[model samples]
Target: MASCKQVESMIQAWIDGELGDSERVILDQHFQECPLCTITLRKQQRCAALLFEGFADHRLRHSIRQRVMENLPEMEPLRVDLEGVNWRGHDTKPKRAWLGPLMRMAAVFILICLASLLYSAWPKGEKNFDGAVGMITQTEGAAFRETGHGLFCRSVALKDFVKFGAFYKTGPNSHLMVSLRGPTQLRIDENTRFQICDDRKIRVETGRVALDVSRDERKFRVLTPSGTITVYGTVFEVSVDSVQTLVTLQSGALQVESAGAQGELKPGEQTCFTRGQNAITTRTVDTAQVLGWTKAIMPDSEAYDRFAREVQPLKIAELPGEQVFAVITTKNGKPRAVSSFCLAWNPATDGEERCGYDVHVYNEAMHELFSVHVDGSVFANPNRRSHEIDAPGAPIVNAGVLHVKIVPDNSAGKQTPLKVSAVGL
Candidate 1:
C-alpha cells in the first residue's frame, strides 16, 4: 500500500535513472498494483521519451538542453496534483525552479575559464636576431661580426672614415636607446673586445671608447677592463687600456661605483682608475677640451659664414641684420644657385673621436630652402669628407627657419653658427 506521494518520488528518481536495483524493484511492484499511480507514471514516461527523442535528434533548439532535462523528472503531469501527495513520513519543499538557469550559468563560466587557460598557455614569438646581438642600426659597414662561444662583435669596415661603435656580445645592446637623444658614436679600436651582458649590463675586455650618451634613463651603463661606469641622463666619455681606465664627464652628472668605493664625476671633471687598485683619482679638465676627440665642424651660423666667405667675396659683415647667406653660381651669364651649407661635430667624448654633421640650404629671399640633420654616412670613410645632407628633398624645404645651428664634438651644449651667401658671377 505505497502512498501516492511515495509513488510520485519514485517516478521522478526512476525517470532520472537514479534508482538502485532494490528501490527499482519496490517501485515496480507498486506500479503493478496501483492503477491510478500506474496511469500517471505512463503519461510522465511518454513525456520523458518525447523530450529525450527531440534532444537525440538535435531538434531541441535551446542552448540549455542539459539543464532543462535535469528538471524534467520533477515536473508533474496535467491530471496529477503533487500538493495532495504525502511526499514521505515528513514533508519537504520542492526544489526551486531556477536551478536550471543556475546550472547553465555555471557551465558557461567553466567554458570561459577553460578558454582563458588555453590562450595563456600559447607560445610567444622568438626575439629579434639583431636585438639579441645588441645591434641597433646597420649603417655603413656597421654589421654584426660573429665570434665563437655565443658572442658577436659590432665592427665597422671603414675605420678611419666611419668611427662608430658596435655591440660585442650575444645579447641586445643595452645602450641602443642612447641614440634617441642624438646620435652617439662609439669608437672601438682594433683588437678591442666588448661584451653585452643580457640587455642591461656591459663589459669591455680591452679597448678605448668615446661615448656620447643620450639623456635617457635606460642609457646608463659603460664597462671597462678596470671598472664599470653608470650614468643617468648625462653626456660623458669612457676609455679602457691595459694598465688604467679614464672617465670624463662632458655635461650633466655621473656616479661611478666600483671596488667598494663610489665617486661622482661632474661637468669638467675626469677620473682615472688604475688596474688592481680600489682608489680613483679625480682631476679637473676643460670639458670642451676633453671632448675634442669627437668634435667635428657642424653646420651652424659660424660654419655657414666661414663657408660663404671662402666661396664668395660678399662682405658678410656689411649685410643687413635680417639678411642671411645663400650660395649662388653664374651659369652662362645667368645666376644659377644651390643655397646650402655643411658642418660637422664629434659623436664621442672619450679618447676615440667620431664625427657627425648637419646640412642647411636657403633660397634667394633669405628663406630656408632645405635643411637636414645627418651623422657620418655608412658608406663614407671616417676621415674622408662626409655629407650629412644627402641629396635635398622635402625635409629641407619644411625646416622654415633661415638660421641653422651646428655643434662639433660639442658635449658642452654650445652650437656654432654658419652663415651662407650667394657668389656673384
Candidate 2:
C-alpha cells in the first residue's frame, strides 16, 4: 500500500482524470480501507468543484479569434453535396447547408493551429536533465555552468543536478555541496573552482573542498593542478592555488600522485605539492581548523531530538556474519507513530553477489507491521525515499526501541556485505 503522504499527492491527478486505470483501481482500493484518505479525497473534490464553478462565472473580456484567424494557414473550401433525396419527400434545397459544415471545419482548424504553437513553445533543452549522477544538497551564492565549454552560468539551487562534465564555482564565503550517486558527500568551500568529470572523478582548478566520501569498490579521484589524489573512501580536504596544491586527511587514507612519485597521507596528516617541483612537503595538522567549516553540514542535534534514531553507519557482515537489533516493547497508554526519512547503503559490486536482508518494523505489542526487503541490485545510496508506519490515530504506545529487526536472508548466504545508514524522522 502507498503511504498516506504519497497518496495525497496523487489525489489531484485522480480528480483531473489524469490517472491510469491501474492507478485508479489502486486508489479506489486504498479509499475503501483508509478512512483518513477517504476524508482527504472528499475535501479535495470539494475544492476542485468550487474552483471549476468560479471559472464558469468568468469570461475573456476580449476575443483573439480575429487575430488568430488572420495568421492561420489557408484551408481547402468545404465541399458539401446535398444531392440525396430530401427527407421531407420534396425537392426543397436545405437552407445554407454549407454554412454549418464550414463553421465546424473552422473550429477544428483553429484548434490544430493552436496545438502546434503550444508544442513549439515547450523547452527544447530537456536533454540537460540527462546524465545526472549527483544532486546539490546545499548551496550558497554558487554558480553553475551546465557545460564546461559554455560561458553562460546560472545561480545554483538545492536539488539541482550535479551533472557530469558541468562546472561549478562558489564566491567568497559561499558554499556548495553535492550528494553524489556513489553516496559521496563533497563540500566545496568558497572561492573554489571545479568540474565533475564523472561519478567518481572531479578536476579542481582552484580553492578548497571537503569530502566525506562513502566506501565503495571504485576509487574517487580529485585532479588538481599539481597532481591527482586517489582513494577508495576517505574524509579529506583539498585546496589548490596558483603556486601549489594542498591536501589534508581527517580519516581513512589517500595517495597523492605528483612529480612521477606517489605519497600517502595518514589521518591527521597534510601534504603540499608545489608546481614544477619534484619535492613533496608533509606535516601533521589539526583537522578542526582546516575543515571546521564542514561542521555546518552536520544536522543540528537539538533539532533532531524528536527522532528516535540518528544516522547509524554499520559495517555489516565482515567477520560477525550477521547482526540484529532488538528491544522488548512494553505497552504504554498512547498509540505508536513511526516515520523514517532517508535510508542509504553502498550497493554490492556490479555483477557480484548481493547481500539481502529484511528490515522489519513492529508495534508496541511486537506485531510485525511492515518489512523493507533490501538488496544491492536495486537498492543503493543517497536514498531520499521515506517510509511511514501505518498506525491509525496513533502514537507510540511504548517507550521502547522504534525499529524492531534486521534479519539476513539465509537463502542467499553467499551475498556480499553491505554498508548501510538509516535515519528516523
Candidate 3:
C-alpha cells in the first residue's frame, strides 16, 4: 500500500489522470481506507472544478467564418448537366433551374462554417520555456576567466549562470561547486581548470572534480587529455594532470573510453588513463578517502587525536594503543548508521608486526552489531610508520555512540602497546 505522504504528493497527477495504473490503484486503496485522504481528494476535485469554471466565460472576439474561408483552397463555380435527361420519352427542360445555384451557395457556406469551427478548436502558438542548463551554486577562493580580460580575482557568485565555453579555475585552497538541471552536483578541486563544453559535456584542462549525477536520459561526459569518462547517474570523481586522468566511482557505474580502449567501473573501483599508455589500468580504492575532500573533510591531526582518545580495548592478553582517527557524522552531529571508517594502527615493534586484532562494534544497547579483523600490516607503514586501514562496514544506530573494542591475537603477550586511530567516513 502507498503511504499517506506518497498519495498526497501524487494527488494532482491522480486528478489529472496522468498516473500509471499500478500507482493509481495504490492511491485509490489508500484513499478508501483513510477518511482524511478521501476528504482531501474530494476537496481537491472541487477546487479544480471551481478553478476551471472561471475559464468558461472566455470568448474569442475574432470572426471565425472569414478566418476559415481565407485559409481554405479556392473553389470553382458549380455547373449542372442535363444532356441525357428525359421525361415520359420526351426531352425535358428542368423547371427548377435556379436550384443548382442555390445548392452551390449553400455547399460553400456550409464548408466554410465547418472549416472555421475546426480552426477555432486547434491550439495556438506554444510558448517555449527557456531554462538554464547549469549554474555555479557555490565557490571559495575560485576565479573565472573573462575571455580576453584574463582571470578575475574573485570566485563565481551564487547562482551564477554557466554558459558553454565558460572557463573556471580554482586556487590551491579553492573549491568551485556547480549544479545542473540534470540535478548533477559538482565540486571542482583545488588548482583545477575546466570548461563547460555544453550541457552534456565538460572539458578538464587540469585538476579534479567530484560529481554526483542523477539518472538522465543523456549520459554526462567528462573529457580530459587522456580519455573521456562517461557517466549515467553516479557519484564519482575525475582527476586529470599532465600525465594521466583518474576516474573513481563511489557509487553507481561508469565507462572510460580512451585511445580505442574501454573499461567499466563499479562502486569502490577506479581506473587511470595515461597519456601514452594503450591499456587502461584499474584498481580498488577507498572511495571515502578519495572523495572526502569534495565533502570538505581533510586529514587533520587534531581530529585524529580527538577520535583516538575514544578507543577502548576488549578481552585480549594485551592491547596495542588504539586511536579514533575520524568520526563520520552529519551536520546534526549524528553518526551515520552505516558508513566507512579509516583506522590507523602503529606497532610497538617489528617482532609483533604480523599480529592480528579483533575489532568489535556495538550499539548503544551494548549489543554487538558486527566485528572486523585488522591485519598486522595495518600497523605498519614506511612513511608514517602507521598503516591506514579502510574499514567500510560499520553499523551505527540512532542512539549514536559506538562501543568499539580492540583485542590483540594470542601471538602477543600482555602489555603490548599498539597505537591506533580511527575516523568515521
Q: Best candidate, lDDT-wise?
A: 2
Tell me which of candidates 2 and 3 scores higher on TM-score. 2
Instruction: Please give, for residues 229-292, the per-residue lDDT of candidate 1 as tens digits.
Output: 8753466767677877788888866666456445667688999886455555689988787667
Candidates ranked by TM-score, best first?
2, 3, 1
TM-score of 2: 0.42
Residue-level lDDT for 399 in candidate 3: 30
Considering TM-score, which of the candidate structures 1 and 3 is the better prediction for this target?
3
Q: Model 2 scores what on Cα lDDT?
A: 0.64
- Residues 200-300, candidate 2: write the lDDT tens digits: 78999999889887665455789998888877678999989988888999998777767545566889999988655564557999988999888776422
Candidate 2 residue spans exceeding 4 A from truth: 1-130, 146-150, 298-425
Q: Report residue 386 deviation for candidate 3 (angstroms).
A: 48
Model 1, position 299: C-alpha lDDT score: 26
How far off is model 1, as Cα RMSD? 24.4
